[model samples]
Target chain A: MNIRELILNPDNFFKDLSSKESSLTTPFLIVLALSVLNSIYTYYETSIIFNLFPPDMQSKMSIIMIFSIVSSFIGGFISWLLIAGVMHLISMAFKGEGPFKRTLGFIGYGFLPNLIGSLITILVGYYFLSNAQVPTLTMEQLQNPTVAEEVISSIIPKTMVYTNLLINIAVILWNLGLWTYGIKYARDLELKKAFIVALIPVVLFLIYQIYGVIKML
Target chain B: MKKLLIFILFLFFLLLINPINAVEFTGIDYKNEYLEPGKTYDLWVIITPEKEINNTVIGVSPYGVGSEYIQIIKGRDYEGNLLQSEKGVGHFIIHIKEDAPSKDYNILAYCNYTKDGKKYSDNRIFEIPIRGKPTLTVENPSVINEGINRIYIKIKNKGTGIAQNIKIKFEEGNNIYALSEGYIKYLKPGKTGTVEIKVYGENSGIAKLPYTLTYSNPYNDLQLVDKRETESRKSKTITYNYKNQKTVEESGNLIFKIIPNDAIDLNVKDCSFPVGKVNNFTLSIKNNYKDSKFTVIIGKYYIGNNQKTLSINYGEIKNITFNIKVEEMGVKEIPVRIIFGGNEIERNISVNIIGKVDLVLTGVNVEGITEKTITGDLSNIGTDKAKSVLISVKKTERVIPLRPYENYFIGTLNPDDYGSFELHAKVINETDSIPIVIQYRDENNNLIKIEKNISIKNLINPNQSQENNDYIPLIIGILFIVGVLFLLYWNFFKKNKKIIIKNNKNNREV
Candidate 1:
């Protein structure tokens, strides 16, 4: 199925895909593309935050950028595997049957929305960081957790944080929708069971995002 | 018989001599009994005969002690005949020389007459006294037209005798009045004696003083003379010049000029000034003279020109201003001396200096709890101006000064003027008050400091209470999160339930 059909008629597309041979190649390419977008967004966001470090630590920003990009690239695939594993295990409770490879492939496709969200967040963050006045801190000040938290929070604009939170919530809901149909079709589970399986992680992730927005306020 | 014949012959001889002596001097009449030197007098001699006589001639001539100084005129001797029981008159014109001494002199009167065909001659001597006359004059008569003026009138004796018991009586005039009379007991010839006459004049002008002088005449006191002329008393009217009437009446003295009561009126117009500031002091002066110059001095300050001269026109009122900075508080009297026409009038002007500067804080507002910043108004309530005003947070046990606004500087504050000041401090412990210090300089450059405590009991700390209790944004955030979640459920699960149920029914029917 094309990207338009997968996004518009995800239930029918995933059900038709589940009936065919489940190949990991397209799913792997999708996950790799999402990971590459996540890494680019993380690298940009981390580079802006690195300005809060002292001059000596800021000189090592290249190393910090590489590490953060590699971790976010790897973390994107791990998050896909974790979501598929969690959904498959929860589907088993309802006596749902699904191959682990098919569940993982469906979960990798769920991250396509995250790639768009990351691109939008990176654009918004660039605008925010361009205008933000970040206060430089000493090593001793950075050691203090409270001082570090205050400095970080002050540098991050509240509007950017709220906007990113709303974008993330929308993206998470879209992924949940795709994952609901993907799990229902690939695991051969009831629609209610798949929705229940999707709602848990989405609700928890939304709670976390709302708590950060409230804390920022 | 021989004794009777001799007695008859003696009696007959005595009787014949008696007829010859019958034409003796009965009395001498002269114009003056006392003859003064360089003067002429007429003397009349009367002679009587016992029987009728014809061709009687009588002549009088000076013959005694001072007769050398007396001369009888040749053509003025009387020559006439005498009758029985009638008197013959002899008139002589005598002149005393300029070098005559003052003494008594005798004049002889001789008469030749024929009685019963026989020529009889008789001579008699009359005494003439010479004495001096006293002439009095006044010298330098002048007076001041003020209260009681003591005028010294020099009484000069311009005669050849001693004048004694001289009494002078002053007559009142139109402008000048006599307060008392004058007396000089004795005055020698060509000598001058001063008599003090007390007088007062109501105005300034020439005053005519008519006076009568009475002195004892030594020549009249020594002998009785025929009353011809009296030279013992003199009457004269003297003119005395009066000046400075207004000056004398106003100041009661003559050492100063005539300054009218309204000539220069001085008044302290404004004295409400501060202690240390250079302020303008106004003095109102009204001039009543015809464009006169005056020097005004207040305390140690001189107004106007280099010599402190101020020229003002007639009936002109001017306000004189000078700078004054008083150091003390209270009502002070500043000595003022106004000098005009070489005279000085001293006066005292009271200046109420009021009080000094006092600063108080109002509308004090404190912000943070740990780091507090106080802002309020500082005012000067006194009459003085305060300069270089500074307000700072005082360091205490529980309060410490902070940065940015530890001390606020306010340049100046006048009387009843106020300025805003802000101070920042760090509060260590919970306290109800924050200490602050205010410093300023007075007009005299005296530094003054005041300490006060600002209450912070009613102030709310935004960092603590405001941040914690502000839940409106948090509630909105929660509501937004719940709405997003409901939308997600309805759009992904609730709305797709019909499609899912239809798919399920198609699968079951197949």
Candidate 2:
């Protein structure tokens, strides 16, 4: 709050952030590769596989499902680039040479957030496509074959509500872990140091997400 | 160099890759111009595939657009198995119900080509519209009888295709004739031809005119119909007949001319050319046939002096001049007579002949034997000379000599200009050769003027035969011209419109 309190605090915060950056580097890369591959596969499935059911079947879904898929891709790609830029700034603060190459390795591990986010989103995209109802009465699939109620229920159910809630809540947790790992990974910070800085967005996002859930409810 | 080569390779690859999905096949297009319901229409199917292929198959299911609900009963593929699963690539035909709904339908082309006796499905969608069949058109028609009723029944095809087995029948009230009896014909699109039907009075109760057309369009599998009726009121014929009447002639060659006053109607056959009030009538023959009957309206003219009955001839000459002589010394105006049958016209002329006298006075006035007197006369001797007729005044020296022919009284003295005058003269009795002339003198005979030279036929013993005479007609004629000018001024001012002087009315000039 005072000049010394504001200035001395961020220096201590960055010193603690650098100590944990060294510890999350190896584990962050492992998880990032996993999440990336997960997002790539689901991206193909939602773009190609979901649209394959014919336009009449696909047309009736709400834009929330459309936005989530699009934003998931956009947020995934943008998050990778933004996290890398932030890591390069951290490397410049450290006076490290080879900024571009080192910055690549530094926050390339930031894909972990989107990867973890997709693992959760895929479960929801799967549920929505399979359970969404057809808009019109299907004659061939009905009376002659006598399509069962269970079949209709299984084909198109309202899964977007529950899936959206679960994924959004998981995203806040995933993003906090990613930013914390990113700050420390560039500066080579310890778990105890990085964990201290991780509380900032953890508190902010929790407040934001709670407000969103309340409005929707 | 290697990097540039790699960049060029990448650019070429991008161009080739775009060919597979080049055009965006937005949707299928169909119009009623070709296929509308039971009517025919053309459907255009364009597909923008996911990727390019050598050839793409298109299928049209004409119910509406969507997952086509056409029944695919279990059938054998080229491999001859139960064809539930789709083959590699092939085509199919589906029959639409006659009562199919008219709307948009989706066509799915399931290409069936066997790969290891299995079927795969690759489909594209196009919309086909189902509409009603074409409707028939029957036009209101007309029949015209120009040079005998030429009944033109034209069944022109206005539809897209040829109307098959075309037929037209005409029904006039209770009577009807199939077009096959030479009363009907067909016309191709945009052309017209005639059909002639010669008809006689059939039963007298029906109208003699044929008018109507029933057109039919037998399209695809549907039968749609419409009707038209011709309007009424026929045109009738009008005939004309004429009659000729008698013509009355207007007299005189020039319209405003002096015709003989006693002319009457010269009738030839039955008509008369009215030569109104004329003695010399020129008869013109005209043949007028009214109701095909000819007649000479007026016969040729007749002259009493020429011929009694001259036949009617337009260019015939009959010179008819007449003269009748009488013995008289007095001034007599004699007339020549012309008669057309009972019609008589008398033309007058003066035939003055003296029988027992040498002279006669027309204007002579003398009370006693005086010198200043003269007389006018018209004479005829036939053989002998006239007497020395003179006025020997017993107290004066005046002598007036007379000529032996008709003479009007000139002034006793001669004038330089010729005009009417009046004066007095005396006759001189002379037995020998003597100058006998009537002279007018202003007292002393200084300017003596002779009125006439007289020849002495006999030396007379008469003491005096003189008279003072004057021609009073010359004074009366001068007064008549002045009277006419005064009457002209009176008539002009009396009949003319009067003008009021608006300005300076107080100043009047008398």
Candidate 3:
């Protein structure tokens, strides 16, 4: 459910794609739908960002929540289609027994994993949000000099930040795996050549994520 | 649903890249919601039970304050009507105007929460105190003349909050060796309380003497504490040299002739007063020469709006009086004093000059029917006490007549319990008298007479005729007639009426 692992394993992403047949659209649509639902629930939890600027700048996480859920949902779908379809197209243009049927089957069944992911995320986040108590920040507590830092450092662990960093790296390696697999499943490339190509997407995404976490830090 | 999805998608994109906002609470605290005179505190709203609770749900939480001074600075239900704003991390900055009444306030947050799409907005209570400048009063602290003993200290809270962990000591004269030992507890707003310190020797003789006191309220949760000091205390001492025959322990007691003797402590040393134009006059003495050697300096003083003081030679004899001249009009209060080492003795004596006064002793002669003439003579003093005058005369047995220096002429007299004759003129403006100036012409060609003034009790008009001789007979005749009428009615008329009534009643019954 944490999408973090999914982003990190390029070989598994394609291996997932290989076992089932799915169009770029179905799993993307499911992810988008789940994301929308998540956003509505987030808004319910955080209300809206009302006082953004000017005199009072009190914004609810609801605004950010809605935006993140929606944009990420759409972007995920788009990215899924562009990468999968282009690789499929590249495979079709090349030689021998381009088994579109089996490939589509592999992709289609692979959608199940993300659907489970979305469902899990939605359920966990929703249940938590619904039952969550809005913690009151005592004016004194807020003004206490060390409480904020103590709370932040204590809650968000270094592993999470580092893992997120790794996820970006994994994004590139996964693309490389898929692209190399295009040659293997559709063009029937030799195992050695396909294995060499599988590592590219994870590397690029890794570089990008390095920039990301640095900026974040 | 599609639009909602798009909105969600858009949000997801932004979150994937956007930075979290910082929550700045610009002094809207009642006390900062801390209840300041002009500033306000924000009511931070956030997701409940969120590990990082920096989010506030709009239109949900109910905020209320217990104080009348709580006003929403901006961005609340209305622009300026009790405004509460979204400060990131669940804090809102509210603005309150100056001149609001200080009080305890409440902000209740109310909102509906939906887990699995179920919604409810419940209320929670938050307390804020809006306080004015805390009233400061320095109370007389309980002092053990021991370590850090405070002769005077204050309990002070300059703000509305309870001042906690207040520690203070007499900054200059604290007997305590270290400050950590001097700890005074909390104080409330505008409240007064005492702090006892035994930082000094509680059993020492110095404990009885007033000392400089100072203190501070470190925590604003209590009342303001003021410092105490002996320097501002009022005192006087009366010291004197007894006949030198009295014991040191029995150095005669003193009485403030005008004021109560026990009203305050007095130190007596060598002091003096000025009489007439002469400069030196004895006022007090200092004779404390038993256990320790001490010196006394006599001084002259002038009292009024502008008081003046001058001291005599140190270690001088106890009975020495100093000389000093002053130029002033009307009533003058001159405080004569003696300062021995640190001991002081002072007394205020008053004198007046340059005013108008007159006096008379009156009696009348009956033969002439004229108002009486005053035959007594009186001298001239200042006008101040002259009007409240008294005069006395005694009949002489040998008639050793008047002389200029007989020392008996009348004059204004200062109150004297030990000196001379008595007569009081307290009630009225004037008293009338008749004096029989008795004269006797003996067989020889000589005249003997004595004059004595007798008071006239009545001032009513005197009638020409004496009517008692004429009215007595008339009154006697009227009395005789009334008696005869009473005798006739009782003996004849009453008896006749009784018999007639009896006869008539007997006939009617038959």
Candidate 4:
């Protein structure tokens, strides 16, 4: 389904998608595109954090950034599968019937909003990081908790974090709505059960995100 | 037998007549036994009268042996009344001619009187000796200008007698002075005797020294002759030439040319000093006369051998140096006195004292949270103005200089004046102070640098624990995030829930 149909008419889009046989091509392509964007965002953020490290340590950060970008790229697809698998398991408890492949495909389509969100977040983050006043730190200074905390806060300001948070919440809510309809149609479950199934993981992820934001303060 | 009787009776009558004479010659006395030419003497004749006589006369006259040289001016004859047994005295004035012969002479004393209308006469003779006159002349008189000069004055006896105990008294002039009088023991006829005189002169020009020459005359007594006299024995003038001895002339009174003690011109060639510090002062002097010794005095108080001795020759220039310390600033005039050739010359040397510049930091203010900017006022507390003032932050292990304001230029600061400066630096952790360098030029264009430590204790870092209390931005960010979350849930979740209910109702109605 097109991005407009997926966003504006998620119920009809998911209903029409469940009628076709499950294919991994379109869903994998969407997930791969989102993973690439996520990897790019991750590379940008990792580079900023690595800049605070000492010169000798910064050389090693390049390798760590490569691994982190790879993990982020792989984690995007894994997260889509994990969300689908978890939702399918929860739907089964509600006496739902659905194949795992269809659930996975529908969950991957739900990540379109995340793809757009990552692009917007990268743009916003690029603006902030480009103009940010970053403090140079030695290994010894970086070890100091107060200096590290201040450095982190300076690099990622409260406004940028909050803005990113609002954007993430909006994207997550849209994904949740799409995922609820996708789960209901793909697993042949009732709307309430599908909504409950999708809301559980999303609510847990939201709580985790809120806890990180609070910890940053 | 009659002729013998008559001679006897005549002798008896002569004795009787001598006893009855009006006046009888007794003796002749002269005041000066030795007569000199061109001089006068006094002579007296005495007579005794046995009876009173009227119109009795007494007289004295030169008779034999060089008598032509002496002339009796008065008492040639005397007419007066004489009493019995009274001594009649006759006074005579005699003058010896300038060309008189030096020999013995005799004079006659006679008395004539009338007794009982008849005339009778009595006479006596005395011898007198004449002495030669003395004439003096000065010769070979000379003087010099350096120090105490010994003037050799040759006194010649031009007369035919001996000049004894000759004394030459020197009179001081405007530029010449006599240290001692000149003296000669004896000078015979046609003989010359030298007298030494000590004198000094103050200037290099013609000078006259008037003197009086005193010597014993032909009678072995003192006689004085000054420059005013026209005789050959009068004191002569000795003219001396300081630069050229050939110019000396023996004319008029005692005249001499002298080289001035102040003939040397003193000039301050170069004077350099700093206030409150010892420095060398130099004086250049040019001597215009003969070689002479000089005592040079620079200032009132001696710093380092202010009094110096120099021996300079004619047409020579010499430099003298003195170490002096001046405590006050600006131009100062020092008096210099040169003592030479028994004279002193005073001069003034102008010395300009350059003041020292003392630039100090008055107040400092450290600004900015992370990147510190130091702003402070610099004051010139010394006696001079400081120019091209610059303030810079010194980089250390913990202090790093920042751009744009790492160094500040303050232009100029006068004495007792101040200027402001600003410098930027980054002080690392636990560094409570940073070093700053202040540099400027004095009035003499000497570059001076001063290093001072500025305390950075007041510099607050944003990462500090105290600054962590400022959580307003974090709180605002959290509140905004929460509001956005609420709005997202209300718009998306509630709308989705209503749509789901509507769909479920549609399914139930179908």
Candidate 5:
């Protein structure tokens, strides 16, 4: 039930969850608290991103960023429910045994390592934010593809972006590893079947993220 | 069969009744087949007798309608006799009315002659095609370059027929003179023939050269006969302005005024010199034309030679170097005159002469030793003024330059003006000469510096005085170092002892 046990001892942490009955509301609140912290970091980073725009556009982007933050918060809770429900259903198909509520609670606890990673990312992002030279970007420059490339290249250092990407990948990999054990303990399935069930949600989430990135480009 | 025999008997009776004539008109020849309206033309008709018949007369009628579009001019020889030759030919001058229609007309040629005591008259009629007139246009007016002009004339036959034998005669005027005539042989319908005429303009103004263009369309295609009509147009006016025309064409007989490649070249061998110094400049005058004499007059100035006039021959170059004295500083331009043949060009020679500055150090007074203040008077002994004068003693290997003895600032000093300065230096070895540097500006406001060495006149042993003054800052610096170390110990170590004692009390209470 404790967040410290979930982080330091994740294997025994999931084993304990398999033996006892837990309430989904408490685990859901814990995940929500971590999501709020991540959203606050997102707000600050988005504000720093808006600073690169011209004065006229920065005012307009402030309104858009507020809308985006509200949508992301709602979207995050829906995604957690969706992934938990999907994992419960997959476990049932594999002839495993577990309550739906327990699977959902274990899925929430599985997000602990990812929350720690998000906290570290916010700290590292602050270091980059202080050293970054905000480019003078205008609405006209953003509309032009060539000028947008120049503005982005000037503001974001390539090495820092690639390093941040690698860190995020490592953090996701760590979260996926924890979720595999969480699924195995909750579903009472083989390790291989638990990994396949865990991998399905993460891979689908990665595909959705890649699709969003391609749409932006 | 009986009807066929009757038809043959009738053809035989008609052939038997037909009589053979002694004289016959075999061929008919006309001067021109195509005629133009409103013009006179000549038509020669050839008449042939059976055996050299006498008293032969030839007549020609070129008309189809009731209108008189054609008329005969001459049908007899110079002796007032009919045309009597092997093939008796008649020369007739025909004129087409101005309002004649453009269509085909019939030309009737009749010949009456006496051949071997029998009179015979023969007549022949042929179709003569009447066409519209030829149009003459001046393609390009006379373009005068240098002194020659080329006039272009074009003739186009806009009529239904062709135009033959085009002759153009260009008339000359006051400013224009014709060099050659323009002529074109033939120009078909919707076709043009271009010709160029060479003309000469004697003066620089508008030249009006009237030209007469004469071309005749053939009334008859065969034979050498033509309409021989003359059509004259108005004169073409061409302006010959030399100032506006700077580009000279390469082709044609162009007479251009020859000058130097560089009109008036003024070269200063040495452009930089001292003020009030005499400098020499090379003035080169070249005449590119032959049989021309040049007279050049120079302006008044301070020169080595009083002769201001110089004469140069044609195609010859004259380089004159005159020494001139510039009285003031800064950049200056000298006026020069270049007159060659009938052409004159005014030019200027630029020179930069700088002013010279001289600073003299006099009346050195040395008062003290160890902390020595050397005083002297600096006077502007040159011909120019000095500004922002400052004096300082440079540091050397043995002697050290000291502070609290600042550089003296003397503002602007005119010619023969003087300013005094006081300097301080610590002399480790009295044998060394103190370098006194004085920085100032010349008449041109340029920053310059002058250095002078003044020998130490009065020397004294001050080793004990330097040793006594050195202990003051050394003792103060050591006392300041001891106070900073005590503050660091009280801030860090004293605060740590209080925290350790508080933690021990808390552990005992637990």
Candidate 6:
């Protein structure tokens, strides 16, 4: 499916893609491309995110950036296979039939919303955080949780953080809607069954992201 | 009647001719009249008679003046007959007591004898004086020079009495000649006087200038008025002890000390040179006397100058350099003789000629963790050049050197030239410093090894955060995000009309 069709009507896009046999390379490449874009945004985000952290923790930016790249590339491939396997099993339980490759390709294409959302989030982060000042922290100051939180809040603009978080949550919901249609068409299953299959990992990931944000705050 | 006249005439003539009728008092004398307190003296009384005498008696007395000072032994009362016409002599032993006052006393002696049926008597008197003994001391004895040395002699009269008319005389030995008789006219008690006399000596040795002093006791003149007065004389010999009488030699108090240029431990700092190579050795000459000048003679082969004139102060040390070369590989001792003011002292120092190479490590910096590089400047601190210079990190039980590239070959390092090298090493927990070994070849192609240790404690334990990598959780979060994206793509993006149906035994795509 073309980018326009995938963006405007992801359900028909998945339906058109299901007629042809899916290649693992294309799905793998698609996931890798999206993951690489996401990792690039993360690399810059990590640099800004750690600006509110202490200096000692900030030096881990390089290691963290490298891990983002490696994990996204390798983790993308592994997750594609895992998602396809899980969906095929779920659809089979519901008396639905589809090739695992087609399901994987359809799931891979479903990353369109996230890819677009991450680009918008990066742009928004740059706009708000361009002139923002990083806070200076010491090991002693960071050890005291109250002082660390106070310092981080003072340094990171509240509007910028809130705006970035809202954009990320809105983009995630949009991707979930697209994922439900894409799964139904790709797996030849009911909308509810396809929704459960896509929502499980997304909910789990949302909970994890919220947990990391809380811990950092 | 004629015969009776003849007998009377003959007897009168015999009386006139008989020496017994001429029994006259001679004189009284003592062996030592100037007697010291608490000493003895022998007093002799003599008389002459013409004829034989019987029952003769000689008596001596101090006339009550010396009765307490002098104790004279008396003659017996029943003395036998004395010889006729022989000079009659009597000896009296007299002892002067310790409590006797220092003064002169008169001594009297009397003699009674019968000759030709006639009796005669005579008396003699003399005086004796008691005084303190005189002491003569020689002061400022000096060395006697060759050929008539005018030695200035000083004598001190350390006594209560005057040394009257003290005449000193030096003995002329085989090796010495006296030009003037040493004499002192008079010296009052507790007074010192100097008398210079000329003497000669042929050699440089401790020569004994034996001298005698003859002095008369000034109080020896008798205080008696009736008897004869005389003086008592005494003689004493004195020897002078003068050490450090260093006679003339070719080099006087000039000492030589030969050493290498480094003037440290003689054995360790000995200079070395390759065969036929020139090197420098330092020779120091010291004068141990006050204000002395000397000409030191070291041959031209050892040093450039045959002789050097050095005017050094007392205990002054001076140094000179000797440029010497030798052909054979052996140790040679060079003797340096220093001469000054007729005296000399010699010293010998050795120079070694053999192949040698020594390495010194400087400016060492070892940094990093287990995989660390040992970087330092290696210098050749020996007299010879080191070839095939190799610097390596030696492995020990606590340290393991990296394989394949552990050593650096520097090729050659001359004396005092420095080169830098680096080697990789890994240290275990037990190791604190790693030993950097340097191996090289000497001029004779002999392998020499040197090792230096560099501490890595500060390098390894840098003042940084020792925290474990926190990227594991971040990696997990990233994987989860990627997993979610993959799932969304699997469920919604791609379309598949034909679905594979799976039965209990077979699965088919329709």
Q: Against the true two-chain complex, what DockQ does each candidate achieve?
A: 0.03, 0.00, 0.00, 0.04, 0.01, 0.02
Q: Against the unseen true structure, what C-alpha lDDT does each candidate score? A: 0.71, 0.36, 0.38, 0.74, 0.62, 0.62
Candidate number with greatest lDDT? 4
For model 3, residues B29-97, the per-residue Cα lDDT tens digits are 221213455554555554333212222343212254333445554333311111134332234566554
Whole-model alpha-carbon lDDT for candidate 3: 0.38
Residue B236 in candidate 3 has what lDDT?
A: 45
Q: Candidate 1: deviation at residue B503, Å?
A: 7.2
Error of model 6, residue B65, in angstroms:
99
Candidate 2 is graded, for docking, as: incorrect
**What order do you get sorting by TM-score, best first?**
4, 1, 5, 6, 3, 2
Q: CA shift at A53, candidate 4, in angstroms?
A: 2.0
Q: Give model 1's DockQ, 2 decimals.
A: 0.03
Give candidate 2 misplaced runs (Cα > 4 Å): A1-74, A84-106, A113-117, A136-182, A188-193, A196-217, B1-510
Clashing pairs in 4: B203-B259, B203-B260, B204-B258, B204-B259, B204-B260, B209-B254, B237-B253
Return the top candidate by DockQ: 4
Q: Provide the DockQ value for model 3.
A: 0.00
Residues B1-510, candidate 6: write the lDDT tens digits.
Answer: 999999999999988885543555576665443666566777667776555676677777776668877886553232346665576777777777766666778777777766567677766666766674555676533343345455566778875556666666766654555567667777876699888877666555445555666675565432222333344566344333222211111111111122112211112134666645566656665545456686666553453555668677766677656676766666766665556555444445666777456677788865444556677888877667899999888888878888654888888998788889878876775466888788888877888888888876443322112213323333433444465455445444443322222342254332
The TM-score that candidate 5 achieves is 0.30
Per-residue lDDT tens digits of candidate 1, residues A88-188? 89889888887899998887777777876777676766655555555555566567776566556656645556667767777887888888888898789
Docking class of 1: incorrect
Candidate 5 regions with alpha-carbon error over 4 angstroms = A2-4, A207-217, B1-510
| Candidate with the larger DockQ of 1 and 3 | 1
lDDT of 1 by residue, B1-510 (tens): 999999999999998876337565688876444667777777778777776777788787778555678877751344556567787777777788866767777777788777667777788777877776667777643324334566677888886667888877766665567788778888988899998877775554445656667776654532332233334458344332323211100001112122344557787788676565666777888986467787877774333332356787888988877777777777878777777655466677888775677787878766544567677898888777899999999988999999889899998999899999888898788788898888898887989898998886534221232234334433443454465466556656665897789999999999
Worst ten-residue run, lDDT, model 4 chain B?
A: B240-249
